[model samples]
Target chain A: MSKDKLTIGTLLFPDYDLLDVNGTLRMLGALENVNILMISQSGDKIKSNCQVGNYIDYNFDNCPELDVLFVPGGIGTRKEVNNPILLEFIKSQIPKVKYVLVVCTGGGLVAKTGLLDGKRATSNKIAWEWVTSQGSNVCWIKKARWVVDGKFYTSAGVSAGMDMALGFISDVYGREVADNIALRTEYDWHDNPDWDPFSDKILEKK
Target chain B: MSKDKLTIGTLLFPDYDLLDVNGTLRMLGALENVNILMISQSGDKIKSNCQVGNYIDYNFDNCPELDVLFVPGGIGTRKEVNNPILLEFIKSQIPKVKYVLVVCTGGGLVAKTGLLDGKRATSNKIAWEWVTSQGSNVCWIKKARWVVDGKFYTSAGVSAGMDMALGFISDVYGREVADNIALRTEYDWHDNPDWDPFSDKILEKK
Candidate 1:
């Protein structure tokens, strides 16, 4: 076990995707010395897009400096992209965190942070047009399950967050650690970074 | 919107797998006229196997008869299979619900109800030996992502529950409804029922 602990904060807003935050939590929170903290703007219980309320561990103002900031996206991300408080908070944390992970339209929220400028990233394919429309400087990949641009990690959509988290575990913790977690979950992970079939599925609908 | 609302009850014990319940919720709860209710022995919030507390919507004593019963397996399942109170509760509901879904080691938990006798089922591959040991009369399949034996659906492991839920939605709802949900999440769902590769992975490890 690593004696050194890494405080991993997941920023939650009202109507956040339940699977988006919870799936990543499975891999990231399971690791030893990785403290998982659910954070929200006011420390109030955040309702899921599914309407279930999730308890928060900390309010934005009181949260400690994070080693990893995990951001998940949902219907709420559309409104929060324009929230100055959230944008400023994300901006302030970018320089402090060791890594920044954005899932689904979470990339949209992070893109609003002015952090994805000149970085390769991705977001929910179904909402691709709307999500990428917010980030002018971002070099968005159209077909990727996930993208790793230096310390920033962005995934395609809801379930793809799990794939990115495992990939992240492989990058930071070791492949063996992630493989064991995958085995434990029995998740046949789409290990190939470009194995994004949903991109075409979403596009084909048009 | 379907005016016929179905109360989907997820059976919660201490240390339940969060992904098993939440992942399926992302699919089933997203459907029209589906009510997601988390039920436990007590209405008090149940702690996930990962230690995060999930608020329960109802207690066993007052819960309305469910349209569907969702059972998820985890580390705590090892102790729950022997609980007479839980087995009796599961038995009582088996004859009332329209569908019974069990995920991962949840197969072990449900098998104790004696409801799975002679029914085709599957469970978490890693815990295959111990889980199968619990339900000798159940016809356990080794190479299946999910087994839909009439109204009962049992799946391989944690993540497999989501795939099973999508399939369940396709069966009860329509393909378009399930496809729309899959598209909204940008999920490349493993549509093939027999696409379980983890069966070999676990066996090879032995």
Candidate 2:
């Protein structure tokens, strides 16, 4: 890859969890040849529920071709799932991107767009049912750090987005690169040997 | 406390974790009457690692008359600690604000301002030593959700800022109001009886 040349697109919508979007962006920015694009439903600044900062860059309609498309989840996904324009855009872009990454409730959006049907997927624990309800073809994985079924990758809850992004980096580059990225971000990234999404271990009493 | 009259200010700096700042802003936006302000050392569009968005307001040279001041932390704190201009501004405004809330590494900035001297404080676990080293007069509470020593309220890590803000609402208003706010925001505001700042159990172990 050329220096910071990987085109990474982050989806933005009203009421989306800014942390998930920003956290992933922070990690990706550390890469030498990464070009991060903030693509929103509209070509305008996206006002987050956090109201801290408004995203601006490319609109879904005007975004340049992307290498990776990352969809972040939040309460915003509840409405974005049904947005015809947004769904069409996502559906059209899936085939062109190298990787499709979804975080938390964002997995539901991917599932809703019919991209994750029959593919393994995961989302925020509270919204796993909603993700499943969107489509039965998706093999929903519960409490997974992140699930990779084919080229579609999904994660659980807010912070999990960072881990999933690192995982994607590992897949594209190498584990060493991902670990160095994690260290630079001050995140402790580990592969859980005992963790099982299908097992009752996560369900065991804390 | 009047409707649409609350002016909330958040300090932004280089390398600041956008999540900590945005998360707190999202919670505050859930309230009916609050105007958010993004203050930076420089009155320019502050770029973060996430590339999610740009700050709208700037309070670099002239501090806005604010109802509350929020400071978020990240690797940026290391640089902010030695910034004479920023430290002077924080010191000048410590006594004027209704509340001074410091999140994550931001607590270190507050500690450097000498406002937390002789008061209880907490910060990101990794930077606890740096915070302590900055000033020995402060009681660095190792295991606490947030240290509410007088008007200075400090929380641990990035996400803990949300809990600390909710607690601030509870203290300023009441538990019932805070609970209502939590319900509206869809956040499960649990009183973590075991919330120990120094305890390794605070975060999910890798």
Candidate 3:
């Protein structure tokens, strides 16, 4: 809860979506004093769905205390949801971090943790059925850009994470700080959490 | 220019902006048949400005034929503009690629090459003076989300590259394809190149 420096631990895995993590990091990185740690199960280079690889800074064991825990969605989450090691890592960090951000299908992974039970969350609309199936007890909102329940923030899809990240900045910093970051990055941030346009288009197709 | 499979080469360097590349890639990754190659000067892990590192797929010497050459912006551009190795690599790829996408201060690096001498372009508004100074002969537009001069595409700040990427997708694919990607990602695509809001805000401040 200290404001001096906030360390954010980002969970990464093989075939993870690139934008889910990096796009959100773009908004968070603009903050003055914040540290980013890329963490994987084995601390090796994690390859994205695009076949691009990123170096990991820490493993689950050596990860330092984090103010924020970021989990990004990708094809890897399908297999990782059943991974007790990764699931245990997410569960153990939830109680310790000040905030948890689940983007895209990452909502499914956290939903599997049984942490969002009786809580509201949202995930990628295209993968709605799979994500919602993971947590029957969790309240899944289909028409939401993002959902914030207590300390957890879950977004709709890949780029929606950027908007949710700005919302997080608005909460942690101030509205002005978030707006300034949007201006700096030239991002037209959908400041309103409920201002989602794609949910109906995608969900209705199903 | 092959319709079957397009190859994209992304240039990376130390202290490169994370979003400048990934945000754009988020839109491009949605394409059905495309290959992404991360290239750097040394074919080593290049550190981003946020201190995160990405593994490079190819070095300048080993780089292959590219359909699109992507250059990302960051604080490193100040120094990279003078890096002859990178400049030569960019210059070498320019004639071969169908399109060259430059994001944020990356315009400065490309401007140093003198290839955009008489072409219209734009860059991160906050770094306008520096970027414009890099190419005195280039016609730099002060207010634009992105500028397209023949085969080259230059965009404003970090997140603007996403809009440009969508624009690129629309140009190569159909407009419906670009809109579908936007809908899928839940991104508010600023379709018009002239719809820049930050240029006057940041540029006027200076």
DockQ (Cα-based) for each candidate: 0.66, 0.30, 0.76
Candidate 2 residue lDDT tens string, B7-122:
88888887777667765665666676777888887777666645544555776677578888888887788888999998887888788888888887888788887778889887
Minimum summed lDDT over a 10-residue window in model 3 chain B is located at B1-10
Top candidate on DockQ is 3
lDDT of 2 by residue, A70-162 (tens): 888878888888899988888998999988888878887788877788787877665657767876788887657778877787877665676
Error of 3 at B79 (Å): 1.0
lDDT of 1 at A172: 81
> What are the lDDT scores of the predictions, listed in order?
0.87, 0.72, 0.90
For residues B1-206, write the lDDT of model 1, one tens digit per residue.
33578888989898888788788888887886888888888788667866565667888899997989999998889988988888888999999998999999999988988899999999999999989999899999999999999889999899999999998888878788888888788777887879888998786678
Ranking by lDDT: 3, 1, 2
Colliding pairs, model 1? none
Clash counts for the predictions, in order: 0, 12, 0
Judging by lDDT, tell me the better candidate of 2 and 3. Answer: 3
**Can you give the TM-score per candidate against the true fold?**
0.95, 0.76, 0.96
Q: Say which candidate scores most in TM-score.
A: 3
A1-206 per-residue lDDT for model 3 (tens digits): 23678899999999888889898888888888899989999997778876676789999889989989999999899999989999999999999998999999999999999998999999998899999999999999989999899999999999999999999989988899999888888888998899877887888867
